[model samples]
Target: MKRLLYIITIAIFTVLIQNSCSKDFLEVESADKLYVDEYYNSESRIFEALVAAYDPLQWFDYAWGQYTHIGLVSDVMADDVYVGGADANDCIYLHRMFNYEALPTSVVSDLWTTFYSGVNRSNIVMQYMDNVQGISDDTKALYLAEAKVLRSFYYTWLWKLWGNIPYYETNLTYPYIADQNTADEVYQGIITTLEDAINNGGLPMKAGSGREGRVSLAMAYMLYAEVVMYQNDDSRLNQALKYMEEIIKSGQYDLVSNFAGLWEESGEWSQESIFEINYFSRNAVRSWSSPTTDGGSVYPKFIGIYNLAGSPDYDGGWGFEPVRADAYALYDDNDQRRDGGILNFAKYAEQTGATYQARYQDQGYFLKKYMARKDGNANHSADADLNYNNNFRVYRYAETLLNAAELIARGASGTGTAQSYLDKVRTRAGLNAISPSVENIIKERRLEFLGEGKRYWDLIRSGYAPTYLIPDGLYRTSTWTTSKKYLPIPQSEIDASAGTLTQNNY
Candidate 1:
């Protein structure tokens, strides 16, 4: 029997389960005995299945960590921020990742395990769709499409980080020993899955009223464009452009005028969001051991300034993921994006008359995009201060614009379209528009997405990682290599597979 623990939060559903986990992976959960047949005999059960498919998005062990296994790790691995905390040893996984010495057993390993857990959960829900009774065929098709797209989203992260990996569409049997697929095969599979969902699965261009968190055509298009763009192929670039253009023409999404306002609690689920991982604070109660409950995100609390006195509108935080001086230098002083993206700790101290000790090369700059507040938005009780109800923006309209710009700059049709999209993001940042060039688009994306967990992938996808990241003083030890691009598979997984699974050259 699968021992399931569902933490029902204000907005998102989070389910954690324990099955016969192997020595190598805490990922797979048996679905054979998930629920009795009568449980799926009602329409409510179908909705519950859909929610369960979405539940893994907020797992504390997966995404709500001090440095989220997926989102925040990319920036830390790149040249954007330092792993700032009490000392050098705090959150050793992030430090190791930044320095490029992460062992297979380190905290980063959990990302593989957890993301696969999401994949499996999505698979379970998808496989059981046929068993659902009395749901409309359209409704059933939409739910199935949602599961596939969500699986694609999860798999994209896995393949992006791990290169070639085991791929399975159906739920695995016990003692699972799956063969790994090449990265190319995996990418093609992901694209095919999403394309199928978009073309045939009856998903609306956008979710219906008040259905912002659910999967939509816009989300599918965004993911499709993003994955193909990462491949950097010319023929597919135009296809990606078409999808992004469709998203823009759909009129279902738009960028929030105020960049800073994007992070306010009131502005969550704003028009800018294409797909956002929902987290909640209301009705949530977190504990040290549990760390996350009620689907709240810990990224905000982890990146906030530590041990500082509360100001008029702000609160202190655990103070990990400090912004480096070089990252701060990326912006012009007057760039609203800078002011909105990073907390100027120097000026903050001057204003608040607060002082504190620094650690882990802290330059006093903190992440501002997801900073937590003390205004009763975090939790119903005084506890769980670390669990902030900040929804993680997985895909935004701004990014779609950027993607379209990059595609156009890279030989897609619509000459002025690239510059037009660039100007939109620039105008939002209160900056004058610059002519569109691939270099300019790259630089614009870096500046625009500072702490939003994109700069690193931007570097890699643009083929600039070796050029820009290697010479940076922040990277410890040897030079960066293409082989180092993928993190090593956990050794325990290899041992469990008994040679069925091969490890990446980390």
Candidate 2:
């Protein structure tokens, strides 16, 4: 048990409980009143404000129809999996995203609102940090750094999803018309904020045991590099290379010997993890509550096997994001990632003499990375519907190595560093090391992180969407155009902006 205390008990900080769970693994409670003005006189109260900043990461507004909308669904929009569920109309927004048919509305709006909620909370926390008295400057700096990094993390999602967005560092007032900043402005803002946290904020290079869920200096370094790499600028790639090299040399992280073991409950916060979003079903008593009170991720429930006439190993779920047959075929038979990364229902049925019932767009496969397990440890939720304890590894050491390799291939120094990094990942996977190149790096990541939410963004950011996603059977849409590169600003947001916000050229 990680200190899930932050999720269950932080509600005492003047925020009434209900509404948003963590999207980045931060648990949330409703702020019945703006407590920042009245609550920061004590050190403990300051800590609560910091935790509140983390809340929007896991928000799931049931009334607003925002159900676990960030990480899992974001990946489904990519070319890796079909929008699997009850039917074609089920999660139709996601299906539209999958087919490049989504407009600026509902699902898009919900995601926008959720991330901005985080931005708002983070701003609140930072403002209140200044009013605290009797707390050590060091303590204040660390907490402030964590809040700033989290705010940047939220904006990274916004910038990546919608290129033009309103940017602000402090709380805003009524009529709330924030002029949209250019994508470059948003990127620069994220980079500057993280760099400040890294240089001035008192964050340690690594978090001590029992603190892996919190932001560390290493996570900030990783985020800095990831943001720069996404730009695909040769000079920035060189800058990213330096940050990655610093992390590698520090030896604070490494690849877990067993890749498959990384996803198991036992693997939570393993040595290979840099930043992991914590989730728990423990001490939770509801089968269904407003997301604000739920502590466990809904990922397992969303993608678990549904209606399987098999042994209890296949627990029932809503069966969303069915793995594509082509994706299963992408893995070599000997590769460890194949069996560990996916649930091959056909193969499971063959072995157990059980029936794998089909669902909407059923492709005979499902993501195994976060599926709910039958082991006794899973039912920590009293309601049983809320039972799932898996944590999401936001940044893993293996990704850092791959980033180094990709950067080197793009144009960086340190001879053989790229190949050395690639070899390490491949060698662990039971294969001979191939020479490092952009093509091979992309291929390796596709296999290594399937269903782990890396594939689609990897292709899109690398500018390969046209080639990798446009085929007839690859996605519902047979055509890919440059205009589809960035998602449009949510229609509601544009309307609310009253001309201050401009839509993307979709």
Candidate 3:
């Protein structure tokens, strides 16, 4: 089993999820102690600070009253999954988001703050690096590069979800007012920061086994690709393609031979993985009182089969983000992803005599990418559902190949041909190779990353959302429009901004 995340052992970092709208993480410290004066004087302490920076990554699931799994939330907004729960009111914000009805005072506000928390933590980590002593210059540079990567990653999420958002590298002071920038401004800033971190040249192409969860050169490149591609910054696309080619030529990663095996317990951190937002269950103390603890992921439990009975293959859960039957239908029967990416509960029940209490949006389909398997949370001490050993794979080599293919198809040349890259993924999926046209690349992504939450953003970045995100049956009556592209800023954030922050056109 994997070791517990170091953040879990540090109660000093437990006060991470601050209730303030300022995202006042700079204030997070021991009681009655000025930590800045006392800490970060040593290398060991600086490493702890670095791990603390990775903590908010786990918070998007349950740090606040209205939680959001970035993957599930993004999928719900797409055609692959539904905001499935006991009724229309359960995770009702997701339902609102699905129909393009989310308001300023919405649950997705938690997502905004969660990502900001990461930004704050990363900033704090960088501050620690500057103050730290007895550390090698190389180590300090590495830590700083990782911090920049993390900050840019969080900013990328904010930019995609809320185009107009506060941008800050240094922590905000009391009243915590950050300069609100337009989407293009935020885009430029994120790209600049990420580019510096990458070009500064300390990040590893692949983190060694001992540092599996840490940021790597490949992860930074992927984040770079995401931000530039999303902004449609054509000037940077060639550079982005070069980054993809770098990963491919390095030969440090490749697709796992067995497609379904990629999600199994043993498949984690395989050759295919570039980054994973980690979750742990061994000695987990993440109760409802401390959902932000370094424990298990709430995502698997949130989307697992609800009220499942006698399921030898899966565990029961709150039942949100049910996959669409039509999405499953689009897959070829011989495609391994059809079995690995989605859980056909109807077929399972018919074949094995298992059952579930079908709640809202019960199409008998579930996301298998991070599905809660049987006994997934059995080792946890409290709130079993809140803890499951599931790590969200942020980047995989398969995507590296796909990215190279897509970019090459769009006229960026590299070490490999577009057809070879596309063919590699297809042949691995037990399918024949097709031409590496941009359309084929897009369709392949829709298939390759079905429930992993790529469909929505893929549509958005490709300018396909307006037509591709059409109404789906009685569920999504509203088709996606340009105005609904960005989510509304949280009302609480706006109020705390003292009229400094502007809300999106939700």
RMSD of each: 6.6, 6.6, 4.9
Candidate that scores best on lDDT: 3
**For candidate 2, what is the lDDT?**
0.76
For candidate 1, the 10 contiguous residues with the lowest summed lDDT are: 1-10
Query: After superposing candidate 3, which stretches have Cα over 4 Å from the reference?
Result: 1-4, 8-38
The TM-score leader among the candidates is 3
Q: Write the per-residue lDDT of candidate 1 for residues 289-352, one digit (tens) a residue.
A: 6553444666676766777674655666777888888888889877888978788877877787
lDDT of each: 0.75, 0.76, 0.84
The TM-score, computed over Cα atoms with residue i paired to residue i, of candidate 2 is 0.90
lDDT of 3 at 77: 86
lDDT string for model 3 (452-475, tens) is 778899998888899878898767
Once superposed on the true structure, which residue ranges of model 2 sit more than 4 Å away at CA?
1-5, 8-38, 60-63, 285-287, 375-383, 414-416
- Which residue pairs in candidate 2 collide? 21-58, 21-59, 22-57, 22-58, 23-57, 23-58, 24-57, 104-491
Task: Provide the TM-score for each candidate, comma-separated.
Answer: 0.89, 0.90, 0.94
Put down candidate 2 lDDT per residue, 1-506, tens digits, no spaces.
45453542454445445545636336544455555477777788878778777767655322145454455666776667887888878877777777777777744667787788889878877888878888898998898899999999999888988878899998788988888899899998998898888888999888887666788988998898878888665666776788788878888888887877888878878878898877777665434545555566666777777776666565677878888888899887888888877878777777887675678878888888877776523546565545566777788888888999998988887544899999888878878888788989999988887877777778877878788776555347555576776787888888888799888986
- TM-score order of candidates, top first: 3, 2, 1
Residue-pair clashes per prediction, in order, are 0, 8, 0
Model 2 Cα displacement at 199 (Å)? Answer: 0.7
